[model samples]
Target chain A: MTTRTPFDIPAHASSDDPRVTLDEALGTFEPIPPYPPRTEREAEFYTLRDGEMFVNMGPQHPSTHGVLRIVLKIDGENVVDLDPVLGYLHRGVEKLCENADYHQAICYTDPLEYISSLFCEWSPVIAFEKLLDVQVPRRAEYIRVLSGELNRIASHALFMGWFALDLGGLTPILWSFIERDEIVEMLAALTGQRMLFNYFRIGGVNGDLNHEFMSRLGTWMSKATHQIDSNNALLNENEIFVRRARGLGVIDTATALNMCMTGPNLRATGVPFDVRRAHPYSIYPELDFDIPSRTEGDCLARYLLRMDEIKQSLRIIDQCLHEMPDGPVMAKMPRLIRPRPGRAYAAVEGPRGQYSTYAISDGTDQPYRMRIHDPSFVHLQAVGLLTPGNLIADTMAIMASLDPVMGGVDK
Target chain B: MDRALRRRLEARFGEELTGPVRQRHDETEIRIAPGDLPEVMLALHDEPDLRFRLLSDLAGVDTGTTMQTVYHLWSDSSADWLRVIADGLSRDDPRVPSVTFLWKGAEWMEREAYDMFGITFEGNRDLRRIYMPPDYTSFPLRKDFFLPDDASRSPGGGVRPMEQTHGPTNAETAAHVRQASSS
Candidate 1:
């Protein structure tokens, strides 16, 4: 209920203390030289004549998305060397979770990846349930898949808007939100929250979908198809959009996997490694859907993959609607949840990427420590690897395709 | 963990297996001495059978006794997930060899571990704080760190103090509100 942000602990009591410098604050962690190859690709395409011109692209800029600041060394328009400076939006979500108990901690994960907050909300709940060995009923499992896929469609719609916004197309984003808002509204009806729906409980959901929600969802599906069509019409085949994003910011399979890029970003690089299919959590294994991927691994492929994924999410939603069982949504929970002294890891294919949570319980009501393995934190690593050779203009396009939510990246 | 990979790791690090490779809630954890962390991780990455090329996550835990570093690894080929735990370091100097050389994805994660738990990842190229500012003196995630208000954070407690620390006490507020309504 409070408006205060976490990670608000001041680094310095006052700025006057010259002795308390940023370098002096480092306990033992040190930054070493010979950083990853500044520009590893062909020099003729994106190299600069000189590497002296360094520019900070973010910490506030819109194109970088969120508060990410990339220190770009330029030669004319060519980027020579780059270093992504993060932590601007750090809210200490991981540190805050340990102090709260099992049920209380689920809400804290909402803002961590707010694009499809239902997905982010599910990771910790899944982890806690796994640790405690709680089994959700069959009906609740179907509800989870129902909410998750709807959230994915909503998230991808927003991505379509923002990605086009990055590429200088305004109308597409406005149109994308028309469909996204309806899906989000449908979710809000189920969860009682408009934006950060902390709806997923340890064993089940906060409540079941009402009759009105199902009726509205049935109507919204037809409208959502038109919204997806508008985005493709605006940006997919357009001459300028394709020319700009076709070959820009291409990453190979080895580098993408090595960087631990998950979700659509990893899938675009031609690796069919979806956590839903590969790991098979919740009701995902029961449902049938394809993990659409592209071999090109460029900005266009990344953008197109998300668009295709929206359709796949719709397919999942269609199945959930047709075969959703009628039963209790809330599972029976113990008065005090005390999972044994062990650790549990659970992941959901979040809108941003593979959002996973590792919860360690020391046989107490409270978790000893909880770590969020956010995909954006790992996916952001590709920024430094992807940016050095491309033009400064293409930077926004590359960053847009990555689709990082600051909550997860800085959590 | 797959049966074959567990045997290979146990065979490779004969006595250094701190304990039996224990299964914690379906996931297997391979505990290694702090000294043998880098070696075990290298073999996990390079050895043909277990290619845990993807470093999913790296985190630090304050176990009341010592600071423990946990590494979660994933194999793309087999979809096998493994947890490699490096234990045995006091709070004063939690030094463990950095695995930045093995997985490039570990750079920021290790930096974050160092940032939160003050665990020193020796030889990590960029060990700057990933979440907190570089100048932050306290390790916020450590078990001992607590805000003054954190003591009173328990739910459904009786006779709770008012949140306004610098204002009138609750009794004073009640009196003031009564006076205003009467006036």
Candidate 2:
């Protein structure tokens, strides 16, 4: 396969055009009012005069999930200011998409949101199919749903594992992975890749599920559910876990709605705002499930909501397997997919939140411009809001509850 | 609520929702003049039927000659989405008004557009680089931007030599080896 080198601009380009350069522009750009100075003495001399310790929380910390650094200003325990420094994992996915073809681009999307790779694949593929108005067969939709649900389970499993690890429980992480490995194996059998599965094509999936794969998947699903139930029972009943999680980083429904938070985080705030139920896509309307929500709007509520959602996902997967029709997995698609000049935005309920792909195609095989609206990007905003009044010790727990996958956030 | 709100939005926004407006696949686009974006967006949020409270995403597309800023706005109350496009920003001055004042989520979205597309948000609080390094040079997303080839630069210019071992295998080397006489 042919591969092009990543684009790199000359260092002197900024010197030639200072307006386009961030450093040059920021040199003269005034800092926001009520700013603190760089050094301790300088900061003390400033208006807010309270002695606050400045600590950088990442660029290396384990809770970040990837390369993410947050420069935080703390007054004793409460955070006064937070500046998230990104780009440590910025592989220039957008720039790469520009050069890659529509089919080739799907490979890149999976890696962007590594945790919910299926949702990432689903959003772009569905967007491409919509742009082209390709009619995917019934079987394809069922397969898509099956894979999507399995992906959701895997994603939530990872979240539960990491969340338990964050809470200083190691055994749950290992147990959660026991199910994750089965799901990954199923995905690999279908898609040929484990982590970054570029299985979804424009019109339909890359291929059909074999009978042997289906039986194996069915066997794994039963065991996974029992494991999920036992794990939830273990974590939920612990008094220390409840004390640390319940009522910590409490956010009301109003704030969540105002901020446009989606997925489990918004549901935890007592708003049944799941994209699957509200704006049904990929035969989700035909499925049997309820949007799990909690009225407490706290860390524990969010955790419980995710646990319950996993059960709902399992229900969807079972329904998909039972009712899955036999037909063509891939719809009839043109060799070159050239859509009419227009734009479309297709969003799916990703593990983190609402993952949307907005594609603008000027009647070409490749999109004119594709913009991805990752939920983690918006969820990161909630971090600054929730951490301000909480203790430094609670920062990791609050962040873990949010489950901000740096891949999605940075991409 | 769904059908009535869309109609009310179309009526209130008048010509703003008319001609040159197109729908493809799942995305809907309503083209508006650059000067009219603020008024159109304000009406979209204010209208009872189309309470698009959240500005989900804002991005700039460089179409060679001109730039088009696309806004993806969603309503949590209604579960509907509206994509508004404002086209025709001059290459020299790619400035657009900040929507962060309306939706708090637009704070970083605008910063990202500014960083990648060099689209200036007139009143954005943080306009620094969001994805690229602080000292990054050109806007890499533009069509004219090209990745420099290591071998093209002069050796004494402090330009690092191309690491021949990395990246895609060179086709020219294979061609040269094939052309060589049998030894």
* CA RMSD per model (angstroms): 11.7, 11.9
* Residue-by-residue lDDT tens digits, candidate 1, A367-393: 878898888788777777887878887
Tens digits of lDDT, candidate 1, B1-183: 466556766788777888787664446677888999888888888887777777777888777556689888777544456888897676677889988777777888887887777788887776766676544566767655554455554443323333222111111212111010100
Score chain A of each prediction against the true chain A by TM-score and list the results.
Answer: 0.87, 0.87
Q: Write the per-residue lDDT of candidate 2 for residues A1-411, one digit (tens) a residue.
A: 233222344545554563333432232312222444433423432334367766778788898778888767778777776677788887777766655668888888889888678889888888888777788888999999999888889888888888878877888789889878889888888888888988888888988997767877978876877788898887889888888898898999878866668889988988787778777888999998999899999999989999999999899999998999999989887677777766678888888888888876776566767788788888887887788777776778888899888888888
| Per-model TM values vs. the true structure | 0.85, 0.84
What clash pairs does model 2 have?
Answer: A130-B25, A344-B27
* DockQ (Cα-based) for each candidate: 0.21, 0.20
Full-model lDDT, candidate 1: 0.77
**Residue A350 error, candidate 1, Å:** 1.3
Q: What shift in Å separates residue B126 of candidate 2 from its native position after superposition?
A: 1.9
Which runs in model 2 stand beyond 4 Å of their true positions? A1-48, B1-6, B15-20, B24-27, B76-80, B148-183
User: Lowest lDDT 10-mer window, candidate 2 chain A?
Assistant: A24-33
